[model samples]
Target: MSNRAKLFGALSLGACLLWFRAAAEVPPETVGQVAELPPMAGAHWLWVPDRLFRHSILFDGDSGRMLGAIDSGVQITPKPPLWSHARKEIYNVDTIYSRGHRGERKDFVVIYDSRTLNVKGEVEVPPRAADTGTGIALVGLLDGDRFLVVLNQSPGTSVSVIDLENRRHVGEAQTAGCAGVFPAGPTRFGMLCGDGTALTVHLTENGELDRLARSKPFFDVIDDPVTEKGVRDGSTWWFASFEGLLYEVDFSGNAPAPKEPWPLFTENEIESGWRIGGAQHLAYHRKTKRLYSIVHEGGPGSHKDPGTEIWVYDVPSRNKIDTFSAPNLIAPFLGPQAGFDATGMLGSFLSFVLPNMGVHSLTVTQDERPLLFVRHSDLGAVGVLDALSGEHLRDIDEAGLSGALLVVP
Candidate 1:
């Protein structure tokens, strides 16, 4: 192998070793009992993360009806901070979203209630969460209880597991450079690292990081025709579908190289399709293994009109299935207090479609209802989409966004 390749390999090994040492020293936190929210017999809640301000938690009535917005009193100030992954406990706090400001995290996590929509509690992220120069942190819950947060650290990135049961910071794993994180199985997770590599890591005894198969980037060529025209920002802005591209690796750790790379979507030639002028919300379907993204029709900032498009891809087959468009989308006009007029004024704005860019966040209901959450480039409006049938649900007014999605078991 070339000298550079050998050096890169050594660096990855050293980083992993340092992380393992840290994990061993950090004992698990004592998870306090989860407080339950007051009974809301027929209400369901979803989270919205804004870029400029605080995250917003919204409530929907039974059968997917629009109930109204939940007041998450926390306001994440500053112009370019992040409030990511809003989630609620089963019946207690309405939701919690991850927040960090100016690259420094003020709170590891924040919580909210369902009935009154008030701030409930806060938790500290594992020591690994405060890494600097990392962009686009993704958080997830594993086996229904444990919390996992992954992000790229300057010069590298790592994954940390929070012992929610004990309510304390716990295990962590240094990973390949990453931009996104996904649950591959019960104890296994997948990440597309920042260095253009995709890897799957399995949790061993005590949350140790086990080497899994990795994949090299197959579609690495930049489409100059589009990018040169000032299109395609390339900032974690692409989506994958059920059969778009699947790279299966043998991560048993018994093979020659535990950190090898492969591609899962090689059989079909998957290409970028429609573009939502200023779109930025993404959703994935587990059963169908399909990926969908939402884009706004107009330019960023102003919400004159917003549109929706659903791109279906099969990950295993690496193919594009179909596309649908919804010209009408609802825009929410938000106010400062609980007495704000949020009724009847739900769906107001419209969005256009932009191709290739992945979504910021997305989710599908049990009944196959695909809900995509998107923000206007420059406005404080949010868009919800029904991807399966291309139905524009409603748009709610929110500010300073990062990521948004629904809570699923």
Candidate 2:
């Protein structure tokens, strides 16, 4: 060999000798060891679905700490996780490809053990629920948590009912112009349509659709459209419109009963250009019978905009009782809630460069002492607030990207 080749060969041999020596010095680590999570409180756990990463992250609302997360599916569109306090389980409807991302697609429901957060079982369903966003109304539990109702919209619109006990798709209710799955009874659900009507579907005990009923159009579809993020109060469902109108529909009887619509904003508030927005996650406390919605100072056609404030209303009385400004969930490195603003390079970058997002989703616990959870979608942070007083309690950062919905158990 030449002189240059000999020099390189010696260097390579010396580097290999040093690597072997270092590897021999370090001990091997143990593997195949699994760990179980501790017991969690019923009302303290919050499920935040990260649509971008396609996973559902669990956080403790009391301490604002991330407990764990479960994968929703291999697909891009994510369905919000459903929690069953009765069965002590969590359910996620998903769609995955047979050969990674480009093969025969399989839509299914994944059951997870609430305590261990492990995969318990899975039920195969039709590929009907893969096109929906992470909306609270896209999925729900029926028949005492035995059946899972999934709203579908992929070129065609329908609701797929999955029998979790039998691990199969039970039935499909054709809701062509309708969207959302609001559980009205143990075996029935209501869906809001695009033509200003609602459909109530009653299912058999075997999880098959028995009959369907349609209610008269109560809200206008052309002028002011009611949002699909409707909240439930026993058998009554309250929906907010783009122009700050609350429409109530009762399903206590065999058919849906429509009640007169009420204005959520007063004369002065409407004049100042205030309307309801944030159609993904609206909070409703069962015990208090109050509905929480994100409100902002925007004119018409801005129903999907993010809101910097939250307004609470008494559903029974049809009156606005409380309104609170959304707190800054993201803490800047050197700005208003942290340091100076527009003073130096760091200050200017923190204040103007970075965007302080607003609340795009909301949820509240059902316990006696309730707490509200608000999500900043772009920031992937959550702000905890007192449900009764509307006071900012704490903020949780690094939650997850594209957290579209929040669920409390």
Candidate 3:
């Protein structure tokens, strides 16, 4: 063959080979569309609110995929969204400035369609709502989701009532020294006061204040205060004190009924310095009646310290069952199997190193097969574990740092 023909043939072959190589290396087509990750992901969705970012990010708990987020707003304390499966909507009370950080202030409650994740409607509220963060207790629903209760604070504590069915502000109730709005019954809600007592505010069907009832002082407000984090089972709200004591208060009656208080740990565990600690420490599963808490070995003034492990308790039996690890920075260095042993030599070394490596907030999904979702606040990462086994299954790295954990299910 001629030299020119041979050269042309070689060049053509090289071009074809390059094209095939490029085709093999190319990634799959990117789809810009949004689709649900798993079947009924909303049932097990994890809603994490980052107060610094002024928003809440939603994740498919089954697959740990980032679904979306809600822009809550800035300069105001974080307001966790209220999730209603029956209504197929998530309600968020937000106070947004006209500018990114400052300008005109507008306070309103927004309803988002859970399926479409879009704003359905909103109701303008008075500008006096509280700017202090209160986790999930800041917002509440009553009367089978007919009325919405929003706590207010401009130095004094009060609550603004909103008629959800009519989408209008109804009235305001003076709660005085009480902080959160805990729905007591069909019309009223309970609040923990500065004096360590509970005040139940009853409302008429039209959302008007009918009367007020108070409970006898049950906890010591100064010594061992009950954290604001409370989980309700039926008409009873379970609270844990800083010293690891449990309070079971029945709000079903006309007034709050405090049950016999008990300590979560035995004398030995107490001696080991085991106490509940974390931004959020209690996560209760209604079916199993199991309350999971973040526990750590620390002295006084460490109530807000990160937890080294999780301890599970059965509410009815009032007995400890399972315990799991939530190790800190050095735990990974000792290998994957090494847990945070607060009493051991390595654990003592970790205390001197980065003692803050542990779970910060936790929430458990209510389902036949339950899963515990824990957040490491300092790192803003999430750990998923089997509720029954306390086995660490996986971690969701995309969750934003420094936020409270909320599960829609």
Candidate 4:
């Protein structure tokens, strides 16, 4: 070969290698980009978290647009963000782990500015009992959002009271054997006990535990237990039992006065296997005084199953006013296969063999035109429905948003 041809060939090979190296070295963008979002009027925030990334995302319920996010640091599991109406601050409770020691961990209530989403302050919460991860109400605001209550489960169950105004952890209240924190009154909260009673804790002006009391055993805990995720409106709380019974408890006074347990489903409906289900199955529209529950056709041990229908009830009359069918409950099974796609056929077959895919949680937006945000865990989708008309608006599917606890501010 000629010397010129050999030199040309060598140069070409070198250039090709350089180009390939440059292409390979190009970097991918970060998994989650932290961008400031413009404020939307009447917007509600959704607690969509990528558990793998240890960050909780706040999404706009109206447009399914991501408003902002908070980094919970490495190996941290953050509770749902609590919005303070009076203080205009967002509070998040997270279990932060130490960098060097895997066992070393600390709990912190991180506060953020409502408008800017900036970290305002962080108060360290002492370690207490952990919970079952059933998406229970772990954090609550009392005294017109001036104080914060966090449920702890370090084997020994108790609640940590945080003085948000003072930005300090005041004290802890012994909940006896009860779990979960439920706002009962202006300066009081309640916890569901294992023995079917609710232990109510009252707070003083300084956010200290003033006293504690327990209600009479209202529901059967073992055979048919009430869910911890009850819907509260004013001083009344609607708790649903495993067998589809609604126990209304009025906390207007010192003790939790229980009303008669009303059957959520009639005898005929029960015969057809209609039951209340889901982690966060029930939601209440306070302004409209409507109660919404996710229901499905399942037998005794199917409380965790996704719901096929949403039953709306008038809170005052305790009568069913409307029902909305949830078609997305099985839409994931069909996939992209129209009729004869092999993969789609396989998906459908597997779906039938597997458990039902339905709504896992429900929340009503605090907007003028309130929309119901339904979270489907198995499909990793959120469906928006008209609160009054029960019209399915749209579905938002994003990866890593599964099993997210919904919060409306």
- Candidate 3 regions off by >4 Å? 1-41, 75-77, 327-356
Q: In candidate 1, what residue range of length 10 has the lowest lDDT sum? A: 224-233
Error of 2 at 31 (Å): 10
* Alpha carbon lDDT at 175, candidate 3: 86
Scored by TM-score, the top model is 2
**Model 2, residue 238: displacement in angstroms?**
0.7
> Which candidate, 2 or 4, has the higher TM-score?
2
C-alpha local distance difference test of each model = 0.39, 0.75, 0.75, 0.73
Candidate 1's displacement at residue 94, Å, is 16
* Clash count in backbone of candidate 3: 1
Predicted structure 4: clash tally: 6
Best-to-worst order by TM-score is 2, 3, 4, 1
Clashing pairs in 3: 380-401
TM-scores across all candidates? 0.54, 0.84, 0.83, 0.82
- In the range 275-376, model 3's lDDT, one tens digit per residue, is 888777888999999999998888887888768799988889899888888644332223212322333675456436543467768888888788888875
lDDT of 2 by residue, 137-203 (tens): 7788874888889888786788998887777888788878888888888888888888898889888
* Predicted structure 1: lDDT: 0.39
- Which digits, one per residue and each the tens of the lDDT, describe model 1 over residues 1-409? 3323533453353354445542224468878634433454222234443423433344341233333333322332111121222344421111233442234333354444444445555565543332211112255445444544444344556776555444555656777555345554446665654444456667764455666656665333232111100101111123322222222333223221212223222332224322332222344565566655443333223211223455656645656676655332112322211123333442121112112222333444434554544443333444456656555565554433343333322
